[model samples]
Target: MSVDVRWLGHSTVTVDVRTPGGSLRVVTDPVLRPGLAHLRRRPATPDPAAWAGCDLALVSHLHHDHLDLPSLRRMRPTVLVTPPGSSDWVRWRLRRPATHVVEVAVGQTRELPTPCGPVQVTALPAHHAGHRTGSGFSRAPRGAEAVEHLLRVPGAFPGRDLDDLLLWAIGDTGEFAGSDAVLAAAGRAPDVALVPVGGWGHTLGPHHLDPRQAAELVARVRPGVSVPVHWGTLHPVALGATMGDRFVEPGRRFVREASRLGVAGAVQLPVGGSLSV
Candidate 1:
């Protein structure tokens, strides 16, 4: 099996998992918005169509960046996998029903039969939160519902939602309830593991994973190769720093510590570059 992992800055990654016949590509949290809040836009823009041929799309959680409906709709993958409570959001944003989105709660594993073969995906526990809130809202009770309905209008959802929904992940700061569970439910190891190592602030959160925490997870999950993400994409709201500076270091940190910790197979790929593993 060969896996091509591309780092489109931050947590967005395009994993092209290959078998003997063809390839099964999996995209993780792709963002294409610019000048969001404090963080500046990525210097380069990655074409979503590059992933147009992907077999499956993985929305880790409901942060705008991860579950951006606009970017999601543009890809048009055969299958969509996300955490619980995400179906409504994805379906609503994509102007589709919940049935179109595959709901995978933490610790749930599903086998997607792709042209290459069976692509196994396990929904692991992430320390994150998802909410749909825009600046404008009236006092009416159903105002939120009305906005949701508009998003759900057929063909109204575009690839732009990926940026509108600012997905915020609280890093691994506190005791995790499902950290061990994610490792356990995975059963056997995966060919490629995409882990987050940056956050919205300088100080990491209990739910989010810093470089060190990501390294530890890498050791635990023991994937063939680990790609660190969730950094360098968006600027920290609190710190007022660029996404590139904040996230670039942690990936290097993960490499050094993982190597020092004797955890092998730690590699970093350039944004828009490809890796065969």
Candidate 2:
């Protein structure tokens, strides 16, 4: 089977995993350059026109970078997979009428018909929580007299469809069973695994996996090939001031850790780079 994977910079990737009949195109976190905070100053920019034509787009979480609305709207994929509450916000932004958005919960799966074959999307557990900041009353006023709407749980969403396709862990801050979803999805071994190797800045957040952690994950999943993402593209607000010197360490750590693990599966590609499997 021939599989094709492209690094769209950061956590975004266009994966063409070969199925028995044809090819399944999967995209992870498609981010455009302009709206993003750090990438704007680059001498050159990624040509959005060249981005992969994806069959499905996966919004790993609710973060601005991961679930970038502009980029998602641009891709306009037929199917969008994301954590609960994501569809509603995305739909509101799109203003293209109610769209076919699938909300997934951890440990569930959904299968969609595709040209190559049926592509299955699975929701893996994430330890990190999603939040939306708000202030002032909107058109609807909060009830002072009566009980108000209960605050929705951070991770709640519609039912999940954890089916045939491999696992896609949205994002996590800590080491938990939910964090282990990648291992479960791989199920002993996977043809290829796309893992988060960096966070928003030089410092690794408690919620995301840095390159070293990603290397640890690669060892556990034991995939035939491991591709690192989520780094080198965006710098944190604090680090952005001095990003010139901070971006390369995570990737280098990933490589070093992989070497130490004696795991020959690690493969690194340049930004907007691609590799055939």
Q: Residue 49: error of model 1 in Å?
A: 5.1
Candidate whose TM-score is highest:
2
Give each model's whole-structure lDDT.
0.55, 0.59
RMSD of each: 9.8, 8.3
**Candidate 2: lDDT over CA atoms?**
0.59
TM-score of each: 0.75, 0.78
List, residue by residue over 1-277, the lDDT tens digit for candidate 2. 5556777777677766655555556677677754464444222345664454666677766656666767777777767776665566566665544236776655566666665655566666555545432313221112111000000111111132322334343333444554444555545455566767776554656667777777877676676677777667776444466765445666777878998998886887777788875
Tens-place lDDT digits, model 1, residues 1-277: 4445677766667766544555566666656555443555544667765576756666655555555666666667677776565565466557644224776654455556666655555554444444434413311111111000000011111343321111112212223554545334434454456666766556676656777877876676566676766666565455544334664687788888788778887886666666765
Q: After superposing candidate 1, which stretches have Cα over 4 Å from the reference?
A: 35-39, 96-99, 132-178, 236-244
